[model samples]
Target chain A: MVEQALENAIPGDWRVNERLKEAAIYSLAAGGKRLRPIFVLAAAEAVHGDEKAASLAMPFAVAVEMVHTYSLIHDDLPAMDNDDYRRGIPTNHKVFGEATAILAGDGLLTHAFYVASEAAAIGVPAERTLAVVRDLARLAGFPGMVGGQADDMEGAQGITSIDQLEHIHLHKTSDLIAFSLRAGGHAAGATDRQLEALARFGTNVGLAFQIQDDILDITGDQDKLGKPVGSDERQGKVTYPYLIGLEQSRRRVEELTEQAISAVRSAELADSGRLEQIAMRLISRDN
Target chain B: MVEQALENAIPGDWRVNERLKEAAIYSLAAGGKRLRPIFVLAAAEAVHGDEKAASLAMPFAVAVEMVHTYSLIHDDLPAMDNDDYRRGIPTNHKVFGEATAILAGDGLLTHAFYVASEAAAIGVPAERTLAVVRDLARLAGFPGMVGGQADDMEGAQGITSIDQLEHIHLHKTSDLIAFSLRAGGHAAGATDRQLEALARFGTNVGLAFQIQDDILDITGDQDKLGKPVGSDERQGKVTYPYLIGLEQSRRRVEELTEQAISAVRSAELADSGRLEQIAMRLISRDN
Candidate 1:
């Protein structure tokens, strides 16, 4: 579904400036799970609104992904994580050179907002667009993802508690996901109560997703994951599985997954059944 | 004057969380010539608009300065430029350590747009607010400042031509100034022609400022400059002075200053006199 949405969102006029056009396509085409946009689309659909409202969410969805990608690129720099592989391919700095990769990441992240603002101006109502912009700014700003990153950088040097770990994951991962859900709901003119429920749902799912990732990093097959296993351990970084035993972490994932479903179900959204199904599928996925 | 503007712009009710407030104040209250905001105010005044109209431009002006400061912080990182001083004091990383400095830079940059958007929402019409957002987006994006940084990074490893040097300076320095001027005019509801003239004036001055900087780096007193002399040469970086010699660079500055003055004069604005005077003063500045 996201693949289709991305294809539709990217125009087919290929005769423009080749450099920019190619860069945009190359970055977008280097695919990830499209988790952010899917959450957006699902949340909008859960409110019994036109799927077309998802169109309003695309630029932000793309922007969030770009920011995420840029962070990964920088993290892989020699000054940071220094990883050589990502998604089974040479990291951006490896393929494009450190300078180009850095600029490419910067370009993508900056352009993301531009793209989002253009969409907001044309498609969403003024007030709603303003709200979307606010939500995104908060999600990407000091108290959200960047703050989380700062904490991660600092925390990596010392021991940390489960609560602190949760704080980091909430900001680093869940904030953007929550924005995705809220933005979709806003686009669909969802009620305040509905938006709150979507936020709750997104937070729970996001936590569950991170916990599952912890489990995978510790025990999952490297071949299946397409990245080194035990890297967190190697780096002395804390994770859910490390703080709470793996068994407990797995149990926590189940608990969070159930809470996520309960939040969505309790909302009594008329069209929420598919989203619930997807949430269940996500928590149970193997690879 | 800039201090008064900043004091007014920053929220006085510190009733919120103390730490976040402190962080904001500590960074913002650090001293520098608030050239960007001055440009904003001057441009609005040139259009016969009240300060209220340019309030939207304040956050943007602040954001530009934050970006400039953040760049200084990061560029001073050991892996980057490795400078020890900025604004006559130890750089952020020097005082705060590498990790905190990195986070501070990231925090400042991300928070900049948040502040700008909030200001836009409050003081400007929705359509005009969108324009401010767009102008900021373009100024900070790859084709503008970041692209210039990329060019600078690449050029550092090799020699560059006068044209390439101009392009770098245009993107690195001029774009934000141009945005400030244009955004101020935008807030004042300047006609398209007036806005164009302001942009032209800004572009010329922006380039002239770089030429002046190049000359100062070579010829200015180390005591007054507040840093080591010949730093750019030490870094093996290219500059206008490096390429054209001091005499030719001075001539270029004069030419660009003339062009800027002419652009402002050509506008024939009812309230353009102050702006013209400021431009002239900026070019003739000795420091």
Candidate 2:
């Protein structure tokens, strides 16, 4: 269902420039694991067991995926990470050129709010919908993801400890992941306590996820990872393994994943099974 | 008042990265006419005719200005227009590196919605606030400003007539201007008729504003216009004065300004004088 909504997020036909839509659709359609959107859905289902209630969270689900995709597109720009490949395909800028790619990223980021606002039309209360929009922006904007990116770029030159590296990982990865879970909870009318639990679960899982990514960049097969793996080392990017060594990074992922699972189980959710399953799955996944 | 709000829009002492904040503040403080924000305030005052109600629209006013600034910052990037100067100062990318400039623009764009959502706290209904979010995104995203930008870049090569040039101008400039007016009307709880009138007023004034900008690019003084003027011709951009003669373009600006003034008068606003006066002022302005 989330897949279909994403496929149709930007209409194929509109009065505006077709190329802009084409470029936006290009990156959004270049599939990731769709993990963020799945996190949104799982968090929603954890709060409200009924299928219809969980479905009410569809717009938020699609919205997060759009944000994630946009960040990747911009992150891969020639002026940023300068990656030519993402998700086993050419990056948006590689295909459409830098100017259109930048605008495509802008379009997707702006349109994500439009998609999130549709939650109101889908029977989600306006207050909750507004809060979700606030969460999305606050967690994804300057004080969160973008700030983390800036720090990652500048702080790489001055890094001396794991604590500072964790700071970057928390904002760059955990904040948006936490926001996804919180938005799902908001859509399902989850209590403040329940939302807090989901945030904890998301944060732990997100940190674990990033650690696993760093480990994979050092050890995984390039074909399975679907892109060049050792680029982190080439770019002098500080990662979990780079600071703490591979053994410690793997141990950290295990501890974080366990904490994430425990948070979901104690949340008093309608169905904590999916959240727990996803958490456990993250720790063992090869991709 | 709006100046104070824009100046303080991004907090100085945030826990996140400071460079991102500085780069965003650099372009924002360089200053334009603050026309979009004023349109928002004027529309709100026109509807409610009270200082308190107009103040409720302050967040939206700041939000539009932030969006405008972000667009300019991105537009000035090395991959985009590649300009080194804006408002007689170095562009964001020129001062900050390309990567930081891109993230700063991303940060501002995302934070604009955060600022707009503050309206709910200021007493605008949640439903109205949600509508404003939708309007802002739809107008500023692919269907509006971004799409127009993409079209402008690609269409410049194919533009052969005045109509095509106007199509680009209307979307690139007019849509956000229309959104600013509509958002203010929304803040004041204007009826559908009032909102429609504001839309018409914004659309006309926005088009007139673009035409005047094109004329100034050709005939205005270098110091007053800020940044170089003839770059439009150098870049082979299509303009109102290019396809239609300069005299015809001047006449078109007069016609649109008259239409905009008439829109405010017919709306039965409590104080149409300000809106009308601003529209009239556009025609004689040198800058």
Candidate 3:
């Protein structure tokens, strides 16, 4: 369902330009776990707001995923991490050239809000949609993703402390992921208590997910991971595995994942079991 | 007023990060004509909307200018136009390093929507703000500015036809300008006919503006224009002066400017004369 929702999110219009659309759709279709969108749906379901609210959250789900995908595309730019491939295919810049790849990222970033703002038209309250738009923009923007990126780039080849790493990871990885759950809760009109639980859930899950990613970068099969492995060590960037030993990093991932599950479960959410499944799937996934 | 508004628009907090804010503010303060925001304000004023309504439009005006400025910053990137000097000073990337520059552009673009979405919190109706947000996302997004940037890059060394040049200009140069007008009119609650006129008015003025820009590249005084001259010829990209000769291009600029003025006049707008001043100032101004 999430995959279908994402597929349907790209507008079938020539006006956005044929090639530009192709560039955007290309990275989007080059799939990830679709974890972010599913987070939205499960949180919305767990909140047990109006059943129809799940329909409204779809756009937010898609918007979060688009922002995530665009970030990956930009992250892969030659001016950036310079990765040559992603999700088992050529990176966007490799396929479409640097200029188009840059613009494709710009297009996706801009389109995310365009999709989010539409939530009001579909029965979500205007204020609710407005709040969600603000949330995504901030998370995907400077104070969140961009800030982390700037700090990470500035710290290249010499990150010394775990605190610094967490600062980077929190903004770079966790903000948007956390926003997915918070925004889903918002769309579902979740109570403050439920929303708080989801925010904690999102943060812990995001931290765990990043550790799993670091672990995967070190140990996962190239075919399964899609992109090349060992990029962190190759680039000499610091990560959890590098800082605390691989064994410790694996333990940390399990601990964070368990806490992430606990946050949602102790809230006694109506759909607690399903939300736990999401947390487990995210942490234990091979890719 | 617009300058002050823009200054106030930058959030005064460490959350945005000091260096990141510096990068964004550096280019914004480097300054251009500030024409886009001015266009927005003038259109809003011409519509004779409520006085408080002008306050509502200020955010949009600021938002539009940020988007415009961000585009200029990204356009100056080494990966894109590869220009060094802008407004007679070092480009963002040249001063901030490539990664910071890229993140700065990302910061500005994302901040734009953040600022624009706040239009509702003040006094503008939520629906109206949503419409303006959508308009910007589309016009500045892939189908609009990014699409044009991609095409312009693709055709840079080999633009063959006038049609192709116009296609580039329409998206690259005109869409955002036109959007400024329509959005301003929207904030003022202009009638449909008036909005249509503003749209046409924007297109003509934008085309004229581009011709003037091309002309300036050839004939502009180096100190006055701030950047080096003859870049079009240097890069071997086609432009109005290159295609039609300076005299013909000058004539075309005048023709388009007049048509732009005539568009609003024919619409029998509430304050056509004020609108005329904007068009004339845009067409006739020298750096």
Candidate 4:
């Protein structure tokens, strides 16, 4: 359902500029784990204990995925990480050329809000939809993802401590993840206390996810990861494993996952089982 | 007031990434005409005939300017127009490396929606605010500016006619300008007829503004324009004068401006006088 929602989010044949649409759709369709959108749906389901409520969360889900995908496209630019491939396919700039890729990223980022505002049309309260729009921008924007990226690039030359690594990971990864979960809860009319629980759960899960990524970079199969390992070392990026060792990183992932599950469980949600299981699965996934 | 609002629009000391903030502010401060924001305010005042209501339009005004400024930053990138200078100063990428500039542009673009959502806190109806947010994204995203830019780049090889040039100008330039006008009208609680009139007026004025830019490139003072002249020829870009002859282009500008003024008059807004004057002045401006 999430996959189909994403597919239908952007028009395949916008008459204004087919190449721009094509470039944007290409990156979006390249397919990451779709973890962010799934998180949104799961959180919504947790709040209401019904699939229909989760369905209302689909717009937020698709919107978050678009934001994530656009960030990946920009992050891979020659001036940034300069990665030539992602998810076993050529990166956007590598495929569409740098200028078009940049614009495609812009299109996706801008259109994400259009998609999110769509919730109002689907019966979500206008006030909630507006709040979601604001939060999406705040989390996906400079205060969150963009700021973290800028800090990461600036500190790339010398990030020596676990604290620095954690700070970057929180803003770079956890903010959007937390937003995804919180948006779903908000859509389902979760109370302030329940929303806070989802945020805590999301932040822990996001950190665990990053730690697992660091671990996978050291020990995972190239075929499953779809990109070469050791890229952190190649890029001189300090990661959880680099700062705390592989064993400690693995332990941290488990701890964070457990904390995430506990937060979900304590929220008194209609059913926290799915969210708790997803947290566990995240830590165990190879990619 | 516009300048002060623009200054306050971004935090001077955001702790997350000060460098990124500086990069965005640098370009924003390297002043253009500030025409878009002024159009926003003028349209709002036209609807309600009061300065207080126009003040209420300030957030929308500032948001549109941020969008305009971001587009300029990205447009001047090495992969795009590749210009080293804008407004007689180093471009954003030139001043703050390409990577930071890219991130800064992304920051500005994403934060635009956040800024627009501020209208709600200032007492704009939630439904109206949501509509504005959606319109902002649609006019600024794939269906509008980004698509226009992609089309311009693809058609750069052989844009041989006035129709093609106008098409590019409408999307690339007119859409955002129209959005600025319409957003202001929406904020002022204008009727649908009034909003449509603002759109018509803005579209005509925007086209006239672009034509005047083309004319100024050939005939205006370099000091007045603040950048090199004849860049259109240098970039092999097709402009109004390039396709229609200088005399015809000048005549077309007058026609569009007249049409814009007529639109304002036809709306029978509470005060159409200022909007009409803005359109008339647009065609006659030196830069």
Candidate 5:
């Protein structure tokens, strides 16, 4: 369903510039876990397990994925992480030139808001819809993902403490992740208390997912990892494992996973089975 | 009013990463015409000369300038325009380096929406506010500015006719310009007729603005222009003068300016005096 929405996003008309379309679709079609959108769905389902709410949140599901894909494209640019590959294929900038890749990312970021604005079409109250849009913008912008990225870049060479690492991880990796559920809760008419629970759940799961990612850099196979191994240390990045040792970081991940499930349970989600499954799978998966 | 709003935008607190804030605020503080925000204010005035409307639109006025500044930062990047100077100072990327510059731009773009979402506090209806948000995203994103930029980059050596040049200018330059008025109209509760008139006026004025900009590149001095003169010709760009000759281009500017004035007159704006003055001044000004 998300795939169909993603495919239908870029206008297929002749006025649609083919190159821009191709570059955006290239990174998007590369395929990841699609966890962000799924989290949105699952959170909404937890509040009210109905087709209506899921349908209302569907466009935003695609929108968040688009935003996620754009971030990956920008992060892989030569001036940034300088990664040559992602998800087992050449990065967008490597495939298309840097300029086009940058523009494509910009295009996706803008289009996400355009898609999110359609909340009204699905009978979302305009006030709530506008709040959803505002939340996405605030949470995605300086106070959220972009700010976290700046911290990451600024801290690249410095020795970092657990606080600094978690700060970066929460914003860079977990802000949008947490918002995925918070926003879905908003869309599903979840009460403030319910939304808070999902936010806590998302935050914990996101941290665990990021910890696993850091762990993967140390242990995952090269071909399966789709990028270089030991890149965090190579890039002078202080990840969870490096700062606190592998054993403690592994334990922390397990704790975070448990906390995430507990959050869902406390929220009294009607159908948290999918969210639970995702959190567990993310923590334990090798790849 | 707009200048103060622009200056006051960035959070001065410690939470704002100083480096990123410096990069973004550096370019924003650089003096320009500040025309976009002014147009937004003026359009609201045209609809109704009310302090309430002006106050309601103020955040968006500042928001548009932020968006414009962010675009300039991105356009000046080494990977993009490669221009080292803007407004007689080193470009954001040149002063801060490329990666920080990119993040700064991302920060501003995201923050613009965050700021714009404040329309609710000012009491603009949610439906109109959402429409405003949608318009900005659509105009700034793929279908408008970004797509036009991609076109400009692709056609650098291939653009041949006045038609293609106008196509690029209308989307890249004029879309946001037109939206400035359309958005202000929404804020001020303009009738559909008034909004249409503002759209027409914006399109004409924006096209003329581009024409005059191209003319300045050919005729203005480097000291006053604050950019390299003859850059369009040097870069193999086909501008108004390159394709249609100086005399006809000048005539075309006159026509567009007159059409802009007539649009306001036909709309019977309550206070279009400022819009008229701006149209005349822009058409006649050397810098």
Candidate 6:
């Protein structure tokens, strides 16, 4: 159902420049769980808003995915991660060449916000739309995702503590997820109290998601994971699983998951059933 | 005077967060011509508008500079341009280290749009504000600057035709300038015809600016240039000077300057003296 909704939301005009259309489609269609947009839609509905309230978050959802894809493209560059495979296919730089990959990443990143701003133009109230923009910018910009990425790059080449690893993941992966929830709430005219609750929920869930990822990196099957296991260790990178033993990491995940679930319940949202299911699925994923 | 203006514009309280503030200050303080913001101001004034009219354009101007700086930082990366110096000092990655440099660039790039949206909350008419946002996105996004950067990256490694080089410059350099002018006009309530004229002016002047850069790269004193003489050739990078020869490039610059000046004059703007002078100075620049 979610996949069908995403397909319908995506613009399907073939009359646009084929190369750009193809590139945009290729990057987006390369699958991952569409968790960010789902969070957005769910948050809106939970607040007694319609799917149209999710419209403000739609371009942003696609945009967040673009930013994620771009990061993957650049990370896979020979100078960076040097990984040849991602999601079971050759990474963008490998297929498109380094220069194109760099540009492709850049293109997607800039276009994400541009596309997202369509919300304001399309009748989301000015203040509400601006809030969404602010949320996205703060989450994605220097103090957040970019800063986290820098920390990760440094940590990869040097020794880092578990706390530091948490900091890195909080910004790099979790901030955007948090923004997804908050942006959806803003679109739906959520109260400040509700927004704060959602923010808390997103933050905890994001950290849990990263911890699960680290655990999966060590324990999951290569085929299901779509990349080699132990690449972090091979690259001398530190992760939650590396700093804390596997058992502790599992315990931490459980704690975070509970925290996330509690935050959602505290918000007293009407339609949080789906979000609860999502949180459970995220924490319990094997791959 | 310009420095004072900028000082007034930026928040004074930014120093509270020491590290993040330092990073932000370091990048913002690293001085350039401030061409983008000046264009925003001048374009607004030329349309019989005031600074308030161009407030939306201010963040965009700052954002454009951030994007420009990011490109420079990335271009100077070891895997890319590998320049050791910029603006008479060590390049960003050199002073800050590659990891921090990368983050700084990413930070500035993302923050640019965040800054631009300030006008949205401050009550710029929704239509006008959206127009500014859209223009910035288009100029800075894939089809514009990033596209140009891609072309430059490809052209750097091998031979490229003069037309391809022009395309690169047009996208890489010219589009933003065009955006600057158009955004200013939009802010100041310029008529569609007036904005169109300024766009023409921007395009011609932008091309001229690149030609002058090419000329400076080839013929200017290394000490004054602050980098190196013949760096383009050293990198095997194709540029205007490389394709058309210095004499033809100079001629093209003059032609473009004249055309730009004429366009600005033809617009019958209320105040275009500064704009015209800036264009003339740009073409006449020796470094």
RMSD of each: 3.6, 1.4, 2.3, 1.3, 1.8, 3.7
Write model 2 residue lDDT over B1-287, tens digit each, in one string. Answer: 89999888875666768888889888889888999999999899889987677789999999999999999999999888898888888999989999999999999999999999999998999999999999999999988999899988898789999888888878899999999999999999998899999999999999999999999999998888875779789978778888897999999999999888888788888777878888889888999
Per-candidate TM equals: 0.88, 0.97, 0.93, 0.98, 0.96, 0.87
Question: How accurate locally, in lDDT, is each candidate?
Answer: 0.71, 0.90, 0.84, 0.90, 0.86, 0.73
True contacts kept of each: 0.39, 0.92, 0.70, 0.90, 0.71, 0.44
Cα lDDT, model 1, residue A226: 74
In angstroms, the error of model 6 at A21 is 7.9
lDDT of model 6, residue B104: 66
lDDT of 4 by residue, B262-283 (tens): 8888887999888888787777
User: A213 in model 2: Cα distance from truth in Å?
Assistant: 1.0
Q: Per-residue CA lDDT of candidate 6, range B1-287, in tens?
A: 33444444334632222344355456567788878777877787788644555554565566666677677777777766677876877777677765466556666667777766776555556567666766777777767787677666656556557776787788888989988888778767788888988888888889989888888998998877767788778766677878879999999999998998898888978788878989988876767
Model 1: per-residue Cα lDDT over B1-287, one tens digit each: 55665455434541222343344445566777777778877787777645565555666667667666655666666765677766776777666666566556655566566666675565666666666666776676667776677667667667558997898788878988888888777767778898899888888889988888878887878887767678788867688888999889988988987888788778866577767787778766766
The reply for model 3, stretches above 4 Å from the true place, is A49-52, A218-223, A227-231, A266-269, B49-52
Better structure of 5 and 6 per TM-score = 5
Q: Rounded to one decimal, what is candidate 1's iRMSD? A: 4.6
The parts of candidate 4 lying over 4 Å away from their true place are B11-14
Q: TM-score for model 4?
A: 0.98
lDDT of 4 by residue, A143-176 (tens): 8999999988888778889888888888899999
Candidate 6: residue pairs that collide: none
Candidate 1 structure quality by residue, lDDT tens digits, A48-137: 655776666666666667666666766676656677777777777676665465455555556556656675665776667666766776
- Predicted candidate 3 versus true structure: per-residue lDDT over A1-287, tens digit per residue: 77887787766664766777899999999987888888888788888744566787988999899889888988898888888877778999999888778888888888888888888888778878877887787877888888888877877667887788888898898888889998888888877788889988988999888988999999998888877899889878799988998999989889988898889888867777777887888777887
Candidate 5, residues A1-287, lDDT tens digits: the string is 88888888775663656798899999999999899999888888878876567877886788789889988998999999998888889999999999999999988888888888887777878887888788788778887888889888888777468988898888898989988998788888888888888999999999999999999999888777767799888877778999998999999999999998998888877677878888888877877
Q: Report the lDDT tens digits of candidate 6 across residue range A59-83.
A: 6566667667666776677766677
Model 6 residue B218 lDDT? 83
